[model samples]
Target: MTETTIVQYLFKRLHQLGIRSVHGVPGDYNLVALDNLQEAGLEWVGNCNELNAGYAADGYARIKGISALITTFGVGELSALAAVAGSYSERVPVVHIVGVPSTISQKQGALLHHTLGNGDFSVFANMSRSISQVVVHLTDPTIAAREIDRVLRACYVSTHPVYIALPTDMALQKIPSKGLETPINLSMPPNDPSIEADVLDSITEIIYSANNAAILVDACAIRHRVIDEVHDLINKSQLPAFATPMSKGAIDETNIRFGGIYIGDVSRPDVKKAVESADLIISIGALKSDFNSGGFTYHTNTKHTIEFQVDHIKIGYATYPGIGMKSVLQKLLGSLDFHRIRHTESAKSKPPRLVNQEAENSGGQEITHSWFWPHVGNWLQEKDVIITETGTANFGILETRFPKDVTAISQVLWGSIGYSVGACQGAALALKETDRSRRVILFTGDGAFQMTGNEVSTMIRHGLKPIIVVINNDGYTIERMIHGEGAVYNDIQPWKHTKILEMFGAKEGEYMSYAVKTRKEVDELFQKGNEFSKAERIQLVELFMPRLDAPRALKITGKMSEKLNAKMEDTKYA
Candidate 1:
């Protein structure tokens, strides 16, 4: 038997899961556990704090399939709770390991410095249960490995975060290493053929009879790790596919059958008709949250829609329980004849969305949002990682069309400001470790960047390379658009954005920085042969624009924001 401590076994489990780095802030309780990370051959990414650590892990998981985050008891775990909540809502799998007081101390009810001045140590663990899919505490050495396996396997199977409360003493306790011999079985329980066949036959019959069929995809396709199946279905069916805002980069956007992004009323007239008028709309991995669904304004009737979800299949009002989407789709794609349905090639195409001349032109010293986003769109390279902040940048990015293999990372549902900066550091490092050729590109507002600006130091410390574009509009333009147009609170003091690299620790000429005001400067930087086009080191470019300037999509979302915000509070039973 390979004898190993609980902490060592935990790290080995993470290694088995393909996690190369563990992100967190070392605490007194977790310090002993952190020692085992390196011993287990896993790198430690000490973040500025636990929250950023959690966000980094989330971003890393979005790219790397899974990630691990470590924190200490009460204070540390609570601080990272918000990030975990975001992971839960967005379905990103991150194993959160929180080091806790030793079992002996807890048994004796000893007060801890980070605790609530009380002897009860169960408060934080109880709170963590709300957001985690699985919660395990390694108080018993005998069951520690089994508990780890259970939690981690649930994490991968559900693709959700799990919490492990590791007491200091238990971390060092020896455990039988036999669990290390076999990999965790990530497979879901075998599907019942009777249930599976009925669901598959139902879906096949519907699609076979439908004349105008459409496919609507969303972010869960990416989360569930079925994006390849999605692409394969698209290729096999040759039917029109439309992505919600969260699904922008999920499919091959350049495909002829790909209609366009559909956001309720904001959708282009052609996309609106293509999706809304379809006789059958198969929405795979569909997330009907208000933002992705345009304030719940999807036009397709339930009778005409078939939804594929993680554990169930919903056709109209009927629910087939226990039939998983992964298997259902696989079976459906295999058995069904795709050409039985009609094609969308004959649908009349609408003219492309028009932009203001001033937005595209750089003749003036002032940079407008209209010109900025589309220009940025043209500059996006294939396979580049794009992280946009929650404000105007998120909405602005919708205007850009990504090339193939591009992975767009954003906290759209969470809409956390300053998330992109911290997430960018993690995503860039993830790409660097996995594929050095693909680059990480960030689009964040000045207000958002200012909140997590310290992340630059961490990025530099790790010797990572990411190109950060700071959209300087003088303040929180998104807030102003939705609520306070000219309010003083929406404004933020300006900082010299490009010089942040030097502030973080870059030697002279070690990296590139640019502060561009005119279109000419932007064009020159994005031109094919420019140094900014290639990132030999961390590149920071600050684009100066008017305070009131905002993307067209943001303008539309702003007007609807009030109505949507009101609807958010509507009771579920109402």
Candidate 2:
């Protein structure tokens, strides 16, 4: 009942912000906050570790646009930073709240758990400054409400990571009523006004003039929830549309306007030739990151180039589009004289090829990631979700066919390993709340799995039965490819695959594991997973295969590394 209790005040503010779940583990510094969470209508989502908790929060925010997490200082905060960095890079609005020692304790210079014997409360906060947009310490009740508003604005408006340090004493302090008040309107980015006409005119000119024009989009277009409009723009313009690796599901693959994924790293030579020869390029909601651009910049010599974003338009040739992609596309569609405009022969043309009735059919390739994904894609339910980690799964899924009804999500920016397991946990939880029959399927490598495999316990405890598929290729397959031969350092220690269920204390017959190698075994495991998903149990399937070929990007990187090695050898003893 004391007014100075910090946890009570903090919870009041969280409730005002409409945050229901605070994902993290309970620790000495944060116990008081955890105790007050239930009363504030906030559920404590306990994960196996802080890293998992951070990933879960990012997953939630991916769906909700904003979410929160709590972790203890130092080790917990440091572990959680990976996910925060991921959110920052990917533009997810995830708020990270870390618990620290009280002001009095810090003044006394007392040793703390997981600390580096330092008495600085800002140590953890400072470490996160590189990735987080804003890092603040909640030590003063007078400025508590203002700080909450500031951090919330930074997160919700910019859609980035924001960190708040909660000292033990501050969590117990009482807050003023104004600090807990909900606002009727929230701050958001507005479309650029002055440049709207210029953007439309420039794009119109390019479309009117080009022999072959194409729009290449990446993950941000999907993350910002504006892919639908971009799709409409491309379709209405009658222009060919291609997507980067992370932007696969932005439009239905079967759409006639849709072109196959463009992999600059391992591009099929034909695709690269098409992009290079194009006269006009419009990149909407796409980031020109190294992973997407094949390490070389594009549109350097293209006569017309433009980028449409939420806030402004950046044009490459002469004029910039300041209008939002959605608004500009909507206006263009409204004003489009479809009868007068004819798509160029080059843009409308397709190479001679056999058209298969079963476009989604898996290729007849045994022991390949691309071959396995299409079969799984065919089994997806309307509302089903796919969670993939970095490496083979990320790049492989780019070419894998997905049903129009299913949603796919993965970390596109930070590309952290071991993120899929925890993200699946959060996605499953979200699906449960929406009264959706959707299920979560996780694709992870064995090496990445070991990093945060303990997160399976969270699923058991929370009643989340996501189908976990562990690709057991022995070690870091991507690294081995990057370094070529004699890269034994990429291997991971073997695990007792089937014994994981017992180790996690899961119920017998409820938890199952399979070591799959042949095609027959792969089909059996899928059938088993489908059967177990209906029942109330966790299923982990271990897939065994040789160190197979990875995605095109990895193959390219590995080849580049081999060339560097050969060059070094030539210089040896000189």
Candidate 3:
């Protein structure tokens, strides 16, 4: 039987899963395993810190289907917990590998530097169990290969993060390579034939009976890899389709039947009415978190809703378990009788117009969120990857329409403040490996940028050419809008934003930086014939905006958030 080292087998499996790079910071325990990465035909993305590594891994996984993150035991793993938890909350697949002390040392309970110094080795793994779908410690070499495959399979199947703890001694232990001859079973099990048929019949009946039916796509459609099926359903049935904020780019924006986003109370008047007034709504992969749903303000009745999830389908008050959306959507397309379904006029929604008259009239005025976002919608090209931070950028992006095949990355449900900067690094790297011509654009606020800003250096080191747009509003604008308008806590120390690239070690000619305070400057920078538009090298643009100005939808949601917080406080005291 052929044999390979334990760490080698693990890396080989990740490579098989299409992970070309591994993201993490190095430490003593994990140092030896890092050597195996290159041999296994994977690149090492050494992040500035473990947290950033975790966030980058999440971003890579979002684009590439699955990713690997490695960290040392205890401190390194703990630092990445927040990012991994965010992955779990949003259902991204990440394989988290932790290098631990030798089994002999663990058995003797030797005091370790990164440990709690209490001779207890299981504490960190215990903490990780809550956030991971599968947590495995590979102590027995004979079963190491099986355990690794098990956790990796779970990660891909469930579309959630999984954890693996590999002791230092286990890194070099001989393991049989025979199991790798067969690929891990990454396919989802088929639904029960009888149950699936019944569910499909019910869905088809409702579609035929309803006067007006609409399809509502959410993040899960993308997560579950069913975008094609969803599009087929919309096209064949001729039903108007709407997307939630998290699923903004899941469907082609130019589709005539594509309505604007529906975020409960925060949706545009026309969009809100169209979605809520529907007699039947086929909601696929809907994750209705507070912010995603406009502070839990979804007005659609449950009885009129049909929700298709990864593992089940819900129609009216009954749920059909053991049924996944991929097969169901495929079968639904075949069963639908197009002649019986009522098709409405194509949705009137279009990307917000590029030139706002009011802004155009005020020629030299500072850029406002209202004007900037819509203008961006017009400037974006097909196949661009846009990463938005969880502040004004996230809400602002909702107002913009994407070109075909553009992928939008954001953490609406998790809402981690500095996630985008690190995510941009990973995304740029992923795109570089797959499609170098495609651009990676990052829209981040100065406040959030400060948190993971160091990751920019990683981009510089790897020769990544991403356009970093810093929304320099002087402070946390989203927080100010929510509760603290003039409070010092919402303020941040200002930085000379144009000097960031130079400070991060970008040599002259390798990078360009601009500070645009007015609309004309923004236009001049992005217009045709400009170097910024070409994206041939790393560029940073400091976009100046009024500190208090925000997206219209953000203002509405912020007020609702404040009210919810106050109500919770009152409930606590009462």
Candidate 4:
């Protein structure tokens, strides 16, 4: 039997899963293990910080199906906690590998430099357990291969982050390479036939009996890799398909049966009526988080909703446990009687056009959210990877419609402020490896950009070309709309946005930067044949808008959030 080192086995597993690049900042403990990344045919994406690395890994996973993140124990691992937690909340598959102290040192309880002055080495892993689907500490080399495979399987199957503590001393420990011959089982467990058939019958009965039916697609549809099945159902059944905030581009917006985004009360009037008034709504992989559901404002009756989730199926309040969505969806697609089903027409009203009355009437050069987002819909190309930050850009993008095959990455459920910039780097790199021609576009607010702006340097370092649009609204516009309209805490120090690429080490021809305050400037820059539109080189555009202005959806959601916060305070004090 051939023998391999522990790190080699781990990297090979990740490579087998199609993870071409690993994201992380190198630390002392993880240094030796990093050597095997190249040997396993994986490129190391060295990020600016561990937190940014974690965010990048999350984004890469969103694009490439699964990704790996490496960080040293204690301080390094803890810095990535926020990103890892976001992955857990949003169901992104990331293998978070933390290099820990040597087995002998950990056993002897030696106080390490990154430790909390005490000898308890398990503290960091303990902190991560709640956020991870599985936490495995690889102390014994004999079981390290088994544990690694187990965690990787869990991460892929569960579609959530998993933690593995790779001890420094065990990095080079010999492990049997025999297990590598048998690939990890990525298939979903087979659902019980009798229960699945009954559930399918119940769903089909509802569909056949309903006057009007709709399909609501959410994040888990993409995460669990059942998008093909969802699309098949939508096409064959001809039901009006709608995507949630987190699942913006799951369905082609141009499809005749594609209803607009359904965000509860914040949705467009047509979308709201189409979804809420449906006699039967088949919600596939629905994650009804507060923000995703417009502050829990969904008026759709549960009795009329049939939810197909990763683990089970829910038909009119009756839950069928253990029946996964993938197999069930495939089976459902085949069983659906398209001829007998009543297919309702999708809401015909499209999103607002690019023509902005406010800008035209005022003749003001300032780009407003209403104009910018709609204009973005027209400028986007097919198969683009769009990353929106969790602020004004996140909400603003809700108004835009993407071209076919475009992947929109955002932290709607997690709502992390600065996730987009780091995610842009990771996503761009993932696209570079898989599909180089696909453009990666980022929409981030100025305040959010400042949080993870250093990741742009990593992009430049790796020759990843992505268009970075900085929405320079002067401060945190999203925060201002929520509570502190003019509060000092919501403000940020202004920076010269045009010089960012240069400051990040992009030399003259290596990048291009533009400052566009007017609607005309944006139109001209986005026009065909323009250097920015060509995207041959890295491009950064500083988009200027009114500091107090925000997306229509943002205003509604923000006010709702403030009222909820106030009500919570009242309840606590009363």
Candidate 5:
């Protein structure tokens, strides 16, 4: 019979479930448990702050399938709540483990340093339930192993964040480690055989009968880990496909059948017509909100749509329960006859225009948003991790053509600023574990960088080298364009953006920083292939662009938002 402490058991189970590293800050309340993390074969990434740690874990999970974050009871957990909420909204699986006071201290109702000083320890856990898909409080040592497995399974299967409250004393309590022998069962529950067959039959019929069918993928396709199945269905069916902005990397953009990024009305003319006019649109893992939909303007008729979702199979207004995207897509691929399917509508559309040639020809004195993004396409090597922050960076990246094997990581649904930086840390660390030579490239605005820029210290501490390009527009450019063009609130304190690498403790030859305003300087930077491409030194570029300039997509979205917000204001007092 094997045995281990509760903390050791927890970390070992996480390691078994493919979590190679845990992200968080050290807290006095959880020092003992933190000490055991290293012995359990898990790397502990100590971040500058708790929130950034949560963000890093969220990003890491997207690449590695699952990730974990550790924090202290009240203050640390609460600070990381916003990041966890973003994970919940985006459907990224993250296990948030919180270390609480000891059983004796909690039973006596002693005032805790991290608490509100009212002796109430349950308030934060209750608050966490709202954001986490599963919440477990490990007060009983006998069941701690089981509880960890259950919560982690929920996080994996649901593709959402789960919370666990670990009492300090209980973490050191000896528990039977037999549970570690069995891996967490991530397989889907058995679907009703008859219902599953019927759903597959219906899905097969839809696939064979449609003359103008298209596959529209979204973020959930990546989060739910059905990308391979999605790719298979697209190939076997030979249907024209388009990915939402959230799914930029889910499918091969070079494929002939790829229509374009379909962002409702804001989509390119050909892309809009192809998707809206299709007789049967097989939307796989498509869960997006008004922001992603360009103000609820998607023209596809629900009556003609077949959606392979996380929990259910939705086909033309009829919802079949107990069906999942992975199984359903696999079954549909087996039954599909490519000869019978035709992209009657999608075939007529031209390939989506990724770069505007004229913009580059007429280079203004200042760096234009249009020219910089496409030019970036030339510098990107294959298999690089490209992460873009919210605002202009995320939207602008859609115009950039990605090479083969490039993974696009962005917080499209969450739209969280300061996300890409922390995410870069985790992505870089996770990338290193695979032994794959990948460079983590990040594009974030200066405004967002100020929010969580200190997370770079974690990268330096761990010797992770990421090429971070700070879009130094001097303010929140997206917010100014969206609602307040001249508002002082959109302005921010501008730092010498190029000084970041030095400030983060990078010595000579270890890091490089640049500030470029003109297109000439930008070209010169990219020409230094040995400097930028070398994974040994971290690179930072402060790209100075026109403050008022925005990406084509963002400009379109901002106008639509203004009209929608104005309508809302008009109706409020009516």
Candidate 6:
């Protein structure tokens, strides 16, 4: 049998799990493990920094179910902690392998890179104390395979980040391969049968009673891969359906029964009114977070709320209303009053009107975020996937309508920037694996793009071509919104962004880039990128959206900032 190190065993387990890419920058402590990873038939996908790498792995996990990232101890561990915490909150399974001082070195007090003078290896415990499900230290080679399998299985099943500390010397320790076994199937945790029965009975009662009942859903349901079941439930029931912002694009918007994202306050007034006045509400896999439910927890008191949630899915302090979300929905399907018309029949709240209104404003040359997004939306096809950075795109793109069934992947609750590009890389990798023909689209602001832009090379090297559309507004637009008008520090030095694709070894047939200024140019390049005659790599399309105005949310936030700024100025003078 070929001798294998603990590092090799970890990589072998990862390979068995079908994880193709592992993100991180190499440092001396982890060099051995990196080499082991390479030998185990996996690519050590390097990133600009540990934080971005963690976000990339988190994104990959979001799309791929499970992923890993390697980093050295101390600085790298600390840098990646924030993203890992975010993943914990969202239930993304990210396996973090941190290189640490050898077991003996740690006990002997040998001076190590990134070690504090106090000589405590409690750093891992401290950093991940709040989030990770398990923090494993691989000390014994004899149980390495078993322990690794156990911890990896924990991460996958629980959908949380887990840390494995590899001692510097343990990289060379060998272990037998037979001990490792694939984890058992990780299905959703068993629901409380009594509660499940009550939910089903209640849903059956509600569906037969109310003429105007709509099913609402959220991200938790999507995480469990039950959206199709939800769609089927809705179809069988023939009930009108609505979605939360987190569940946007989960169901086809074009379906006559589908009502768009319901942000109770900011939602189309009519949609809100409909939800409020509806005789019954059936929510599937939904969480009643303040941001999602307009601060009024609808399902807080189960006795009063006619809702059901799939149980046992809690992310951090947030305990969602469980399988009530799924089971109740499915149960209601058989009880619908088929004669009732679909909700769209009376939807006074039509899609937002922009072209006519914006044209009247005469800021035709100025590219407001609101104005720019709708145009971009118009360009995308039905099955295209959008990977977005968490900046202006976060606020701007949310305003536009995505095509039915098109996937819009964003770190909405996490709000992590720089996730888009690397996520685009992962998504493109996923596209190739699934043998999908539709292009993976990436929308990122310049600043966020700079944060993880190096992944472009990773994309090219792997032949995973994604159409990267960069909104070159030059700085952190979101920061500017948060910090007010004087925040010039949020800006960055301008780069030849369009040419970087070439610099990254993109061949002529493989990729193309454009610097767009006018709306016409934006339209042209977007059209061309979709059908662009390129044979070598992915198309990198750069559009200089005029920074003439902010998105609606930003504008409101800016007004609030201005008021706060004025109050501060008055206080300073007083």
Leading candidate by lDDT: 3
User: Per-residue lDDT of 444-475 in model 3, one digit per residue for the tens?
Assistant: 99999999999999999999999999999989
How would you encode candidate 2's per-residue C-alpha lDDT over 18-127 as one tens digit per residue?
Answer: 56777887778887778888887787789888889989888877656678888987878888888888888888888888888888887887886677787666677888
The 10 consecutive residues of candidate 4 with the worst lDDT sum are 346-355
lDDT of 3 at 545: 96
Q: For candidate 3, what is the total of clashing residue pairs?
A: 0
RMSD of each: 2.2, 4.2, 1.3, 1.3, 1.5, 4.6
For residues 472-542, what per-residue lDDT tens digits would candidate 6 score against the true structure? 88688777766744467887878788888889887777777777777666666656344662323588777
Where does model 2 exceed 4 Å of error? 1-19, 107-115, 178-181, 184-187, 297-302, 317-341, 348-366, 524-536, 561-574
What tens-digit string does per-residue lDDT give for candidate 4 at 138-245? 888899889999999999999999999999999999989999999999888899999988988888888899878889999999999999999899899888889999
Candidate 2: C-alpha lDDT: 0.71
Alpha-carbon deviation at 19 in model 6, angstroms: 1.5
lDDT of 4: 0.90
Q: Against the correct fold, how does model 6 do in TM-score?
A: 0.85
Candidate that beats the other on TM-score, 1 or 3, i.e. the better one: 3
lDDT of 6: 0.70
Model 2: per-residue Cα lDDT at residue 115:
75
Of candidate 2, the 10-residue stretch with the lowest lDDT total is 348-357
What is residue 272's positional error in candidate 2, in angstroms? Answer: 3.4
How does each model score on lDDT? 0.84, 0.71, 0.91, 0.90, 0.85, 0.70
True lDDT of residue 507, candidate 6: 78
Worst 10 contiguous positions by lDDT, candidate 5: 345-354
